[model samples]
Target: MTVLNNTLTFRRGLTLKNRVIMSPMTTKMSFFDGVVTQDELNYYSLRSGEVGAVITAAANVQDGGKGWEGELSVASDKFIPSLSRLASTIKRNGTKAILQLFHAGRMTDSKVLRGVQPVSASAIAAERPDAETPRELTEDEIYHLIEDFKKATERAIKAGFDGVELHGANTYVIQQFFSPHSNRREDQWGGSLEKRFNFINQLVDGVISVVDNSNVQNFIIGYRFSPEEYEEPGIKMADTIYLVDKLADKELDYLHISLGDFKRVSVSEEYKEKSIMQYVHEKINGRLPLIGVGDVRTKEDAENTLANAELVAVGRSLIIDPHWTSKVLEGKEDTIRRVLADQDREELMIGNGMVEFLDFMMPERLR
Candidate 1:
């Protein structure tokens, strides 16, 4: 087997057939009521069988956590039937399925929240030009949010997913709490660096406790995080190193970093020379598997990425080539289409919303 064809066993002993995991991309294909639509199922089914695993688009863990239109939800048991369809569709191709759990926090627009003020660790606004300052979450609310995540885990367990990936990356609630720029709480939820991690600590502990008692074999838990941010008082490589150290010791199945380029250099001046992936990998130090992701488009790219971490996640590449892993394994790498074309949309079963996203991302080709 090629490096990409290798089976990967998580800490919980849940194994995947290959190293090519499909990175979660927002499909915007779910129903407005937070139900998983047929479009969502069809989309996942197309790409599910070929990759080692398919991580579903971020599903809000609670009602207030929804971030985008058509985002999936595991917030309530009422949504379990739809969630089960999502999990089963992905697993039908014999691939391991991991559901991503998320909360938008201050990143959400009030309009999206139906006029509700978005909540965050502090009332700080994002640096975006039109970003609104969010309402600070009260202590009771913070604890409730922890339960919210645990509840989502329960839903995932009931839905029959292989695992759940905490959406700690991007500018979501988890990142907001971890980021100094966004978190200004003087209470237990935020303040000093260690206190900032308190939320995640309790969250992981809570989720793990549930998974432990579930009696399901190989129900793994993974975390995805952005290593650094551009905002002042934001997370930097040094801070990420600290966070990784703590997370690694927690017996997580894997640590997945969010990046646009696997080889991109650090935003922090002191860590300028080394790539962000390298910095994170060094911090992990093989304590747990690390899934390296970015613009890993070609077989060579995947192999090179494996040099830094244990696995590679193909996002846009998978968006354009649903059978990317299958092609690589079958020595049909030369047949892969690297760019999107207008004509290819129909056969790929692309939904109207997904087509719009592709159009936005690759306008020239889609046109």
Candidate 2:
């Protein structure tokens, strides 16, 4: 079998049947109470059994962490039952289900938060024109938040998921703690780069402790990160290299980089010759597997990405074609959907909320 078709085993013994993963994307299809709804179960069910694994939409770890309307919640025991159904839907077809954990930090507005001001490592606001400055998290609050993550992981294991992925990208709390623009604290959690990483250091350690005791066999734990930031004094490739180096040493099953284009080059001209994933793979140096994702629309795209990273995740492509991996592997790549239409919804099992989000965010994809 080819590299993309071969089963790859991780450090902890969990193995993927293939290299294609369904990258986590928000669906806004859950219930208002943060419970997994039938719509969500159906949506994921349609896409499963084709890919090696599915990293689900971000599940907020606390009530205050909800980033958008209809987001999933693993913050409490009450959510576990529905979460179990969601997990089984994906895993029943022999695909691994990984629940992604996240906290929005300052990315959300007070209106979405229901009058609660968003919190971050520091009080600084994002550089976006309409971004609101978040309230600074107290030292005690920081510890509590880390516990929230651990608890969420515990819940994931309870839900019978194959693993959990820390949503460390997309300007969320984890990225906020690492980004210079977002985290400006003078305490041990901020200031120097090493100090700024303290939160993640403690977070991974705490989570590993939970998994260790749970005895959940072959349970995988992964971290996803954005390689470079565009903000002033933001995280750059060099900084990401250092960060990846440190994370790779932490016994993680894999490290996934969040990027829009799988073949995108470095934002800084200094490293323009190589793609960001290539640079990160170099830094990783076989310490751990890396998952590369973004705009991977074809069999060739996934194949090429696998050259640099051990696994390839596709979000938009899978959205347009639910059976993408199967089609490619079956030598029916010509039948793959590169774009979508209103009439194809039933065939692809597309959900209404998914169509709306894609329309507003990427209208061109819909013919």
Candidate 3:
């Protein structure tokens, strides 16, 4: 067996049976009201057991933060029982379950928020076509939002999840606050690089405070971030390195770098010599465990990723083959599905909503 099967333990005492992790992918299978549904449970049940941990799709921390129609929510106590079932389903056969928390920020339109104007650190519209200018969040609103994240963590703990991943990547509310292109405010929450970091710094502290006070033991807290942004004045590699340095000091369990290709170098004019993984890993310098993911489909790919990251996260590969890890563990890698076919949808437990989403975001994957 390759080193991919090796076990890993976090500083906080959470141990994984192996280095494989199921990266969180939006299934859009939850109820319209954001409650976990049976379809969602079945999807996780089929994929959870073989991996070390499964990070569920982004769940909005507040009602106004909802990004899509079928996304999950941990904003209130009413979701605990449903979320409990989800955590139990994923924890089968020694697998760890982590719920991802996020808010869409300006990424969502008024329609998604039921006519409520989307909020962000600054009143700016995203660069995308037809993007609506979001209302700037007030100081009181920002503090309340941090409290919302804390309450979400409490809900995750009560639901028996092994951890919670703050979705600070992909231009979400957290990333929006950190991105100069998105955050143009002059308040304490914006302006200088350190000021922009105020939102996530406080958010992480609030969430960690919940874990510190919770009765649960070894409840992990991880942060996911995109290493670079495309827009000028956006998050450059230097900015991300600074963020990594700051995060290293925080008591986080892991840092999951979001990338399209694990081997990708900096897209910015500067820092193009090494892969994003190598750069981030160098900055981390063994201070925290990192989860690396991007187009990891084969055993060799995962093993290679292990060279840089503490854990390897497989997303599309697992969606194409629910038993991807099991097959790898059993020496059946030759039989694993490489491309997703239309006819395999039912057996794959892929919902219609997810199918539609994949069609839009990753059309080339579906054949």
Per-residue lDDT of candidate 3, residues 1-367 (tens digit): 7777788888778999999999999999999999999999999999988999999999999988998899999999999999999999999999999999999999998998999999988898999998999999999999999999999999999999999999999999999999999999898999999999999999998888889877788789999999888887899999999999999889999999998788998877678888889989999999999999998988888988888999999998899888899888788999998788788888888989898767765678757
Give the residue spans of candidate 3 off by over 4 A. none
Provide the overall lDDT of each model, using Cα atoms, as 2-decimal numbers. Answer: 0.89, 0.90, 0.92
Q: Candidate 3, after superposition: displacement of residue 363 in Å? A: 2.9
Using TM-score as the measure, which candidate wins? 3
Model 1 residue 106 CA deviation (Å) reads: 0.6
* Residue 296 lDDT (model 2): 88
Q: What TM-score would you give candidate 1 relative to the actual structure?
A: 0.97
lDDT of 2 by residue, 112-153 (tens): 788999999999988777888899999999999999999999
User: What C-alpha lDDT does candidate 1 achieve relative to the native structure?
Assistant: 0.89
Candidate ordering by lDDT (highest first): 3, 2, 1
Q: Whose lDDT is greatest here?
A: 3
- Looking at model 1, report the run of 10 residues with the lowest lDDT sum: 358-367
